[model samples]
Target: MSTEERPPKRPRNDYGSSDASGPPALQRSTDYWFDDGNIILQVESTQFRLAKSVLAMHSSVFRDMFSLPLPQDEPLVDGCPVVILCGDRSEDWTHLLAAVFPLQLFRTRNPTLDQLSAILRLSKKYDIPLPRSDCVRRLKCEFPTTLAEHDQLDTGWMHIEIPGDLSITQALVHLVNLAREVGLFSILPLLLYDIIIAAEPGENDHDNPNVLHHALRKLSTADEIACLRFHVRLMQPYHQTPLKWIESVPCVECTAAPKCSVKIDLLLGLALNAPNALIHEFLTQWDSHDDWSSKVCEKCLIVAKAVHETARQKFWDRLPSFFELPEWEELRKMDFE
Candidate 1:
């Protein structure tokens, strides 16, 4: 056998030549490429060209790692060093870098769940305070811990435009997972309530009816029970307690108040069949021209709405208790800053 031709050597970076046993160096991503970048961060096989100074300024971890004296034995490429970051996905690094880089990679702050998850995970791991804090702020803005915070949200059902392609359920599920991941426990009760609203038993869209089911399955048994308990409270008929107020409210529009009470009783009974009905859902129907409140006098409608609001607030104030969480005031007083 004649002598076999040896393959040419690959380019070496500050890290070293790629291990023969490992995969070859990945192609540099066009998205994150910086022509004047001083260093290449290699995560898995993928390469990210970035400024060491910027990274060091934002991350204590990076500062310490970069401060270590370089060995003469280390490899170099294109007069730049290669820093191999093991145990991280290139996809995550891409999102993390996008958040830090001066250039706006994406047009909006509304990052997808995957993007948020990756950014949060890497930012925490790298001890990059800004990205970590940014992620939490964005999440908290979307899933407020208190009713006041919830009402202050600029976009409500009237402005139900979500930032990205995600549905309300998907966004809520993402928040639930993110809150759990980052130990933002205070937001869980509200998030779970939103998820329950989406997972209404029978009338939910078949396209992804089980999104809540799948998300709930990830919870501990106690948490699951807490969610179910809250759902039960939400769906429980208030015919005897609150619905009876309809009969008590004086209405001149009808001569037969007792018969009108029967009609209101029947209308409120509809909630018993609706597993996902919220106070607002029933109130909206009642206020509409087609429901029992429509037949009642304007005074009756006003009283009914006021009573409904009070009842809804009472239920809301007790939400944390249903989930075995601390009081809302306690959650509000605890500062993350």
Candidate 2:
């Protein structure tokens, strides 16, 4: 299959230490509870003695698995079943257990990117709704599905907290992988957009040995070309004249319509030099404009507002095509049920 057509691969996890013939040696965890626990779940070399009921409540997968009668040859620790789970990390189990138990306020707070990522993967895999939904909701908050949501945000929304020792580029790279792993495709466009932005001069090398490089390596030649084209488009100046439509609109409030037009035109010209200049940036600068609003008539402001909204919408409509993604309508439906 083509690289773009292939499914994203899950990162190799630490597990399966005791897949051999005999029962694995028990190394019960001191951190996790052992008293009144009915099961010992082994992830990698670490063993966690946790309540079966607690796990079953959060996860339908655990519930269904526990419902099955234990095999005659199954291993046991203190009469409790010792289920050795493979292809997962002990840290992931810790995060999952932390989220399910009342001992920690996992659900009542925002997690670090690493914690959130762990919760997302484990919750989705184990069919746990609360953590999974919260993770999805958090991602959607940053990577909104609709143009309306995106419009409300500023350039400030592009900056996120870089967790751990990772640079901004590395953090974004991790997010992209996490989004794909958890089936949260809605976040892909925003993540990819930000990655390209962060890869600018003095940020980080695209060829660096990170998740971002690996992701790029997985793209097909066509998708890579599309990405390059999209980057070029993002860098290009928004050269369309904002005065084109607003100048022709009737200015009823003032007899000095020509003067009003000159003021509005000057405002737009100044906005083009603003950092990361785009139609939205131009509109925002114009709308909150302290100087120009005083100079222009009310009719001028009204017409300018209409022109700005139209220009921003047009830009939004073309964004997905730049990255070779589906249209906005189709993109919004991507990860939904």
Candidate 3:
């Protein structure tokens, strides 16, 4: 019998090979290509050379995977087994690895929103508890449940440096989407409120009714409808309670009732015309407006402040209801669970 010549045995030591039968040539990760690493993870067209021990130490999923025996035909690169990571973005892997091995010089700086989002997602996926817990803590600090924490917050609570091209509206929308995906419902009310206020139309918006804010357009239809509905319903309680002083005849002890009444009317007009009046914190003390204190009496100011405080607390208590969400306690419980 004539012996049939078999096809030449495929080479097993072809490093960086891109033959037709093999995977496409992968670009080595600029930040994660460790020369001595024992495992090669390929995400999309990018390859990250990393230590298996380091990955197994941090992630139980990786530890368990490494404990299993590999197939006889497993592929290798530079003698390290190649693991093809499917259904994950290379950008996310970059962020996760950066967090895992943060540079010493930038250790003090907070991660940008994009980095935080990626860490939160990948850490959860890999069951890396430390980074995931830290991310959640930072997120809770930014999107607090209590009104007191919200009032005390600085202009920018999260980032050390926001990208110049990314507006506050875009950031809020990104955060809202991330929060929804991560099941962080406790923070959704404040995030949604911020989105609504940031996307409120300007005076010239009426001239172009069809023009939508870019950030508002990004919102899911369900969220867009919920926010609009909440805004409409908010006006009634807002005017009747926190701004009820506007409709009052003035404090009975007013030294100049007529003049005080005129100032109140002016304020009422301003409130009615203000785009975010419904969501504005009525209890916010206006330090720069000395005219209000000089024009309006101490007794009237005190009364207005008291009414505003009570109404505002009640509003915060029911904030989740406006967005058709579970109560704050329930939402918080969901987070812990």
lDDT accuracy of residue 33 in candidate 3: 96
Residues 1-337, model 2: lDDT tens digits: 9989999764323344444665554456767957789998888767898888888888899999999998897656677888878998888878766666647544345567777788888887788998778667777887776667865676643323445577665676677777767777766676667666655543244355344344455455654566667656665555453334445433666667777767657655765554243422422434554664576667766765677577656765666676778876776576631
Scored by lDDT, model 3 comes in at 0.75
- Per-candidate TM-scores read 0.73, 0.71, 0.85
Ranking by TM-score: 3, 1, 2
Q: For candidate 1, lDDT tens digit of each residue in 140-165?
A: 67766655566566545321234567
Best candidate (score: TM-score): 3
Candidate 1 deviant stretches above 4 angstroms: 1-24, 71-74, 102-109, 152-171, 202-212, 219-222, 239-256, 273-295, 332-337
lDDT of 3 by residue, 281-306 (tens): 44344443465566576767776556
Q: Which candidate, 1 or 3, has the higher lDDT?
A: 3
Which stretches of candidate 3 lie above 4 Å from their native place? 1-24, 203-214, 247-249, 273-278, 281-292
Better of 1 and 2 by lDDT: 1
**Residue 202 shift from truth in candidate 2, angstroms:** 9.0
Q: Rank the candidates by lDDT, best first.
A: 3, 1, 2
Candidate 2 yields a Cα-based lDDT of 0.66
